[model samples]
Target: MKCADGGGGGGGGDTEAEDGGGVNVTLTTTTLPS
Candidate 1:
């Protein structure tokens, strides 16, 4: 899942990994100049 571009404010990415009935979530953020 990804959030819409925050108009140069910032952006983030979320990933979910499933492993043997376990769920792992990873989050990443990106920065951009307007």
Candidate 2:
């Protein structure tokens, strides 16, 4: 159904956003220590 697909898409978007934020934080920390 359309509703189910929409929900799944939203969840995937949230996960991607969180992953991107985590990666940015890790890069910043690594750079700061060098």
Candidate 3:
């Protein structure tokens, strides 16, 4: 399956998105220059 690709550039993107949102949140919070 394309989702099984090593690049993680396929159906797995959705899963990553869910799993990665926390990273984005922390990034935004830290980068906000508070």
Q: TM-scores of all models?
A: 0.13, 0.39, 0.34
- Native RMSD of candidate 2 (Å): 13.9
Residue-level lDDT of model 2, residues 1-34, one tens digit each, is 4444444444555566865655554455445544
How far residue 26's Cα lies from its native spot in candidate 1, in Å, is: 16
lDDT for model 3 comes to 0.44
For each candidate, the alpha-carbon lDDT, in order, equals 0.23, 0.51, 0.44
Query: lDDT tens digits, residues 1-34, model 1?
Result: 1323332222121222233112111112222222
In terms of TM-score, the best-performing candidate is 2
Clashing pairs in 3: none
Score candidate 2 by TM-score against the native.
0.39
User: In model 2, what is the error at residue 8, expressed in angstroms?
Assistant: 0.3
Assess candidate 3 and give its TM-score to the true structure.
0.34
Model 1, runs deviating above 4 Å: 1-15, 20-34
